[model samples]
Target: MDRRQLEYFLAIVQTGGFTSAGRRLRVAQPSLSQAIRALERDLGTPLFDRLGRGVGLTAAGEALVRPAKQVLRDFATARASVESVLGLTGGRLDIVALTTLAVDPLAALIGRFRAAHERVDVRVTDPELDNAVTGMVLEGDCELGLAESPGGVEGLDHLRLRDQEFFAVLPPGSAIDPAHPIEVAELAGWALVSTPEGTAMRTLVDRELGRCGAAPRVAVETTHRAAIVPLVLAGAGATVLPPRLAEDAAGRGAVVVPTTPRLVHGAVMMWRSGQLSPAARAFVELARLDETALPPAGTAGPTRSP
Candidate 1:
């Protein structure tokens, strides 16, 4: 099947309907349908099954997703190789980031990368699952991934960007004194605003709390990482957060304090092991420079809560 057919197929999968995919691709609905039909004929199988007004991927379509994405990424990389002669005048860089690490290092690195390569379009998306960043990067869904990789992934090249320290964030007017570090066990009595179980953050929280022989009294469990701070601020419950986020929460009137046995994780950038596109290489280099500017892991002193 042609690249157009693959593009149309993926677009339909992403947008959830042929009409929506047509609008996204600026193609007529009939043409998009014809392209998919042609692709299915070439493969001798239907890729998508009609479901009322929507469509769902059939087994064949599910099987094609990874290879289709890889093919498209390879095509883009080929084009980028030729375009490199012009020095990153324009290209797309797709990144999948863990929800927790997305705002701090990713945002800062992207800001610097964009400042230097204004024409490059950087698209950042969250992984479907907390630990799915590596799989997404390996599957060619993204060129780069930012994740909590205490031990780097086996098949990918990685650069440890920073060590993140987790802190206890309490709601406004918390009786706990900010000057004193708190033990994880002390948090067991209070309800927590946490991400769902199985998420990286929740797993860490559970492990630490379990160490104290206490389980979290979860008052609010949300999949939306962004809402944790707000929920805590609203006095729903306390939460565990990284230093950067905890500091922000403090600035916004939440009480932040270091934990007795500090919770820390290494954040790393991962990519395919071989040669990278010029834009991706430049981004990696920028990350390296940024990392160097920061205080070495564990050396950076604790942030005093506001």
Candidate 2:
């Protein structure tokens, strides 16, 4: 059968009905039904048994389902591969994030990658809008997506390659007993400057705060990680920050305190196997920081948050 017929058939199987399948495929319902019928007739067997409003895949149809999906996926992959060769390192590069990742190693990785793949053009999109990114990737609008781990995209492979833990950024010269790491309730004593209350990272922070028997005293809330450092530097209050974002702040009078419940943040790479741009694939491979949090580049400085 032609790719069009194959695509319609697969859509039908995936959506579990002719109408829904046609909607997803963006083809008229009758047209999709006709294509499926043509495919079944050409194969000389009933592909699906229509029982009332529901339909079940027949033995032969079940057999075709797996290979059908592969055919469609492979076809899309081939198209992307061809397009990639024509441009960025022979393909296009696009990215998405969740605010947190936009701040740190993503820039580092992109800079290093562009230096190596000078011919490859890369475009970085705002990290706030992930739904659009996922939709585009699924529809082959972009070559790759970087996002939070635990994304629920079907039919795509996601590789989680980087991780960082939450560290409390203490205000410059604020005194905390060095013997015992501060508890959450004690943390509440400090004016709290943090990300917005309902954000993903904030939610995790709240949960951990509850676990440690303390409620955060809300002082200043912002989505900006860079702002967190200055707020703390001005003695606004303590806030949770990733180690990389708090980098070298100790010298600037900021203390990175490690928290006990370990609020580690992670980044995942999402891409389907196909023809991929060398730049995109390299970013995926090289961008994921060592998931294993290593010893810091220097000796014990201001202690990281518990």
- Could you tally the backbone clashes for each prediction? 0, 13
Give RMSD (Å) of candidate 2 vs. truth. 8.7
Error of 1 at 249 (Å): 1.4
Score candidate 2 by lDDT. 0.67
Using lDDT as the measure, which candidate wins? Answer: 1
Candidate 2 per-residue lDDT, tens place, 155-272, comes to: 5677765565666678866666433455655666777887775564676677777877777787888767567778888988887766566655555778776655456656666775
lDDT of 1 by residue, 1-306 (tens): 888899999999999999899999999999999999999999999999999989999999999998899888888888998999989989999999987788777888899999999999999998767788888888888999988765556769999877777889999999988888898889899899998877778888888889889998899999888899999999999998876788789889899888888877778899988878889999999999889888765564345555
Best by TM-score: 1
Task: State, as a TM-score between 0 and 1, how close model 2 is to the true structure.
Answer: 0.60
After aligning candidate 1 to the native by TM-score, how far in Å is the CA of 120 from where it should be?
Answer: 1.1
Report lDDT (CA) for all predictions: 0.87, 0.67
